[model samples]
Target: MQEHIRQLFSENIQTMIAAGESLSGPLENAAFVIVNNLVSGGKVICVGEGATSALASHFCQLLLDQFETERPCLPALALCNQNNSLQHSHQQDYLARQIKALGQSQDVLLVVSSSGSEPSLIKAVEAALTNDMKIIALTVDGSGELSGLLNQQDVELKVPAHRRARIFECYTFLLHTLCELIDMTLFPQQGDL
Candidate 1:
């Protein structure tokens, strides 16, 4: 079992390393946008559905908490927080409303949607766009309908994995890598490894 586990980890790491090279440039650009926006007093908002919500929360927390980055505690919110007092439809409405309430024009919205086509997801994306917020999407190659909404030049990062579990695993790996890269870029001796 341990050997099998090690193998799994090794394979995953290799896949992520490949994905990293393909995505590094865009991820850096996204991080730059995020850092600049925060410096200008804007918040970072993350939105997703189902498991991607978990990813969003994890990414948001990591960005806000990692000490090496030395970044201020910028306002970061996960729209999928169950405790957020909004119904599904209301939450959809609130995404745009919340952005307007909390986000500045240059603020960043990192939207992680493997499928990307969920109504709530679409609603949130629309809201982000309407608010003139910069967006960074971490998604899958043929994530079907969801892929359609994403603009290739819009800080979009896509993994080649097609299966949901594969996509989810790769998504988390890529996001963590981006965060690590950002931290390294911002603070050269941050011990990112």
Candidate 2:
């Protein structure tokens, strides 16, 4: 049991280290994308597949409540929150509907998913594009069709792992890193925090 647990820890650490270099440029770019939208008075719209939506909500909470700072709340919301999904998951267009209703051309859609293959997620990406919104997708390295759908304006923090658990773990870490970068960039007193 101990060795098994240690191996799991090792795998996660290794994945994060490998991702350090690969994801830096894209992640930094994503931070600027988000910062640009925010400073422009546009909000962030977060969505995801299955349980990943919880991560979306958590991110919104972090942004809205405060990400290790006392600065003003950043505008953000989760289109795929538990209640919204429960009320509308029956329709494939659920997320798209919300995006069309609330999304603005200046908004950034932060899409979180382990596998980027869900039909609904694909539809969500298409909807965001139609709205002229930028996208920041946090997904596994080889995440399928959803990645293909992203245009040059979009940023993808592709996790450098094949295992779903590892990818999800990386998402959490990456999200934290992203939040820190945004906070430090937007609020410069962070001093290498």
Candidate 3:
């Protein structure tokens, strides 16, 4: 059992390394766009489903609280963090409506999904487009509905993996990287060693 655990750790490390190499460019672009949006007085709105919902909330928390350094709070919101009184169908429409209501042209809609086919996420993306908000998608590789929805101006960070667990892991790492980049860009004194 110990050997198996060690192997799993090793494999995850390898995946992280590969993901860093392949995704660095896209991640940089995402960070740049996110920083521009925030500086322009726009908030980041996150939406995801299932396991990715946790990631969406985590990303917002990191931004609204702090990633590593002490700085002024950044504006962010998790679409999934809503009242439970709404019906299931209402909940599905809640995110779209929220984006349409709160989103601005300078704001960014960050969507996370391992399969890239969640209906609610798709709706959020469409609503963002309708509102003329920028989109940053984190999804697994391969052509899917979510991928198809992205336009040339949008940024899509596609993890080059198939397994859901691995994809989620990569997404978490990417989120952390984004937080770090945001912090570094905003507070240059807190540079990583």
Candidate 4:
């Protein structure tokens, strides 16, 4: 049983390492964007579709509670929460409304999707653009409607894994690495205790 648990952790670590290799550059860049916006008084808004939405909310909680510096928590908000079912019904419009209501020019939107082609996810991307928020997209490399959303200026991070679960796992790895790096960089004196 212990060996099985160890093996499971080993595989997970391997996946995370591979994901880090695939995502390091964009992850670093995204971290810079997130930290910069946060330092400048802009909130970080993260959105994800389906299962990824849960991941998004989790990321928000982690960022709010664990990742910070002199900038404080920087207002991590999730769009698709249970309390906002009325807004969630409209999908894109809900995202647009939220962006308009909560986002500022300095804000950043972190979009997480496995396929990245889902209408609702695309709509959220468009909504973020409409609100002039910088976007950090985490998606598979091979496909997606979000290709149009990626540009020279935006921080677009891709994971090599194509499977839905694998893609989201990679996303989680990226977010965890981001949180760790941000925590250390932003609060260096704490060290790696």
**TM-score, cand. 3:** 0.93
Supply every candidate's count of residue pairs whose N, Cα or C atoms clash at under 3 angstroms. 0, 0, 0, 0
For model 2, residues 16-59, the per-residue Cα lDDT tens digits are 99999799999999999999999999999999878888788888
Per-residue lDDT over 1-193 for candidate 4, one digit per residue giving the tens place of the 0 to 100 score: 9998898667667767787777788888888888888888888898887788888888888878764333346478988733445655664566666777887889898888778787777877787788788998877777568867866657887777655655676777778877877767666775254
lDDT of each: 0.73, 0.87, 0.88, 0.76
Candidate 1 on 54-84: residue-level lDDT in tens?
8999988877787345654546777653446
- 1-193: candidate 3 lDDT, tens digit per residue: 9999999788788888888888999999999999999999999999888788899999999999998777789999998636678877677677888888899999999999878777778888999999889899998888379899988878999898777778888899899999999889988887463
lDDT of 2: 0.87
Clashing residue pairs found in predicted model 2: none
